[model samples]
Target: MGADTVYVGYVGAGAITFGAPNVLWNHSERIEAILRTRLAVPVIVDPNEARFKEIMEQKGNGDYADSYKETKWFSSPQEAAMGLDNETKDKIDFWILAAPPHFRGTTIEGRDLELEMIKLFGNKANYFVEKPIATTRSDEPHKVAPQLAENKAVVGIGYMMRYLKVVQKVMSIIKENNLRVMMVTGRYACAYKECHKTPWWMKSQQGGPIIEQATHFCDLMRYIGGDVDMDSVQATTLEHTEPAGEIGVINVDEQAIPPEDRIPRATAAFWKFDSGALGSLTHIVGLHGIRYSNEISVYADGYQFRINDVYTTPVLHVRTPADDSKEQVFSYPEDDMFHNEFYAFLSSAIKKAGKPPLPTEDLLSTEFLSDFADASKTFELTWRIRDISDAHADKLLAQKAASSKKASA
Candidate 1:
C-alpha cells in the first residue's frame, strides 16, 4: 500500500449471499470502483472456512469472475485486526465490516475488533458497517457510540435507500419548499416463501422481519420525517399458528422451530416524530414468488411525494396544489443506491484526508443519514418496536392460558 493507493480489508463475505445478483453487487465491487483501485488479491476475513472455500470455488462462474479471485484470508475478526503487519495496517485506508449482525462483537479475548482496528490503524481508515448493527438485545452499540465518536471514526451504516435519487429529489423539494412534514407512511411487502429461508426466519437470530428487513423503510421514515418519539411508539404483529391457510404460514417446515421463535407474518407500527409529525409502517411477508413491493410516502401542506418499488425500479410520484393538483411522475430505473452510498462514504473519507476536492453538496449531503450514531437510533427504534410487539403477543398468550385453565376447571 502506498500514499496514492487505497487498500480495504473486508471482514465478511456474507454480503455475497445476502445481496441480489450475488457477488456482482457485493460491497467489494463498489468500494473498488470508488477508490479507482483494484486488488490483485483481495483480503477476506471469515470464520467459516468451508463457506469461504465454496465462494472461492464458485469464483469463475459468476458475473465478476475475475473480481472474485482472492488470496488474503483471515479466520476471525481478531486475526484480521491484529494479525496484519503494522505497516499493512497503517496503510489500509478503509474497512468494510460486512459480518452478520450476531458476529459483530468483541472477540473471545474481550477485544472489540472494530475499535481495535480503529486504534491499530490510527483512526485513519473509515468503516462501512452493515445494518441492524446487532440482532440481539444488546447495549453494545450504545456503549461503543461514545468511543467511536471520541475516536472521530467515520463509520457509515448500510441504509442505502437514503441515497436513492428519488429520495434525494424528495428531500430537495421539501427543503426548497420549507415544507413541514405532516405524516410519513411506509409499506414493505416481501415474498416470504421464496426467500428468507435462512437464519432470517428466526426471531432470535435476525430480530424478526422488522429489524432485519423492514428496518430500511423505517430508517427512511426517520430520515425524511426526523427522529421518532420512542415513548409514543405502538406496534402489533400477526403471529403464526396451527391454522393451515393463515398469512403467517410459509413453505418452510414450521415444526423445526418453536412457534414462539418464528417471525410474524405481518407487523404494523406507528409513532409520533420529535417534530410532531405522525409516522407509520407496515411489513407483510405473505407474498409468494420472488417479487417485493415497497413504498414510502410523505405528506405535507398541499404536497405529497410517494416513492415506490425502491428495490428494483424506483419511481417517485408527486402531487402538488401549485400545479393545479396534476400528478407528476419521475422514474429512476438505472439508479444504483448501493453505489451512490459507497461513493458518498469513500468521498467523505477522501476529503478528510485532504485529497483532491470533490463535489461537496451531493457527496456528503446524506452522510448523516447513515452515520454510526445516527443509525443506532434507527436500530434502537426497530428493537423497541420488536419489544413492544413481543409484549403484546405475550399478553395475549397469557390470557389464552388463563382461559384454557378455567375451561379445564
Candidate 2:
C-alpha cells in the first residue's frame, strides 16, 4: 500500500493470440511467460472456460507444463475486478480487454462486450478494445464521444503499430517533406484461410473476418493516410466461409448466409481521402503478405514507404531518388505490442491532459477496422471516413510544406 504497485489484470488472459488473436485457446501459459519475462509483471489467467483446466491437467501428449499448472484462474472477470481493492484498482492503471473470442471475427459483439465493460468499469480512466470496435455500424464512438468529452476517459483500441518507432519516423519524414498522400495500398493475410471460428464470429450476429481480423490494417491505412475521410468506397468478399453465403468471408466457406447469396473469395475497397489521397485495400484468404507478411504501402510526392509484417518492427522500404534510395530500418523500442500498448493506456489514464497513448478523437482507429468488418457482413457500408475533404485540405499540405518552408524561403 506504500506506492501503488500497478496490479493490472488481463480480463481474458487465456485468450492470448498469435498474429491477430489466433492462439487464444492454447497460448495462455506461453503468453504469460512472455509477459512475465518482458514486462516484469505476472499475467494471471482468468476465465471460466474448460481450457483453463488444461493448465493443471498433465504434460503428456495434450497437457501443459508444471509451471503453468499454477497458472492463475478466476470464475469471471467481474470477480477478478472485485478482487483488486481500491489500492490495487487505483494502481491497476489500465484494463486490457483481450480474450480472442470477444474480438475475433466480429465487431458488433466485440463492441457489445466493450460497452458492457465500459458500463462495468465506469470510473476507470482507460480500457483497451481490440480492432473493429463496431462492425455493423460505427456510431458507437459517436455515442460514447460524449463520455470522452465529459469524463475524458481515454480508450485505447489496440492499434499498436501506430506506436512503432519506425512508423513514427516515416510519418515525421512525410510531414517534413511536404509530401501529399497520392496513393495507398495494403494487404493483410494469414498463413492459412480462416478455416473455422467459435461460431459467433462467423455469423452476422457477431461480425465477420474483415472487421474482426482485417481491421488492424484498415486502421493502419487510415493512420498513415493522415486520417482523411474515406470516400467512393466499394468492396467484395470471398466465398471462403464454411457457409459460403456468410458476408465478409474471403476463403472460409462457400455457402451463403440465409442460404441464398454467394460470397466472393476476397474483398477490395477503393476510396479517396480528403487529402486527395487514394486508398485501396485487399483483404483476402490464402494470400499472405510479403514473405508471408502483412504490408501497407504508401505512394506520395515521388516517394514511397512500404511497411511489411507490420506486427513487429515492419521492414520500411523507403524509395527515394537514385542516389538517395536507402532502406532505413527505423527503430522501435517497445517491441512488445501488448506491453507498450498497455503502457500507453497506463500513461493516458494516469496522466490526464497529456499526449494520449491512443487517440481520443472519434475512435477513428477502431472505426477503420469496423468499416471492413461491416463491409464484409453487410456487403456494403454507407458510412465512410468523415472529416477529410479535398477542398481546403491545403492545411494538411501546409503542415507538410511548413516543415521545409524555411529551407526554401
Best-matching candidate per TM-score: 1
Q: Give all TM-scores, in the order shown.
A: 0.86, 0.62
The candidate that wins on lDDT is 1
Candidate 1, TM-score vs. the true structure?
0.86
How does model 2 score by TM-score?
Answer: 0.62
Candidate 1 Cα lDDT to native: 0.75
Candidate 1 contains a number of clashing pairs equal to: 0
Q: How many pairs of residues collide in each model?
A: 0, 25
* lDDT (tens digit, per residue) of candidate 1 on 317-349: 999977955889988676788888877776666
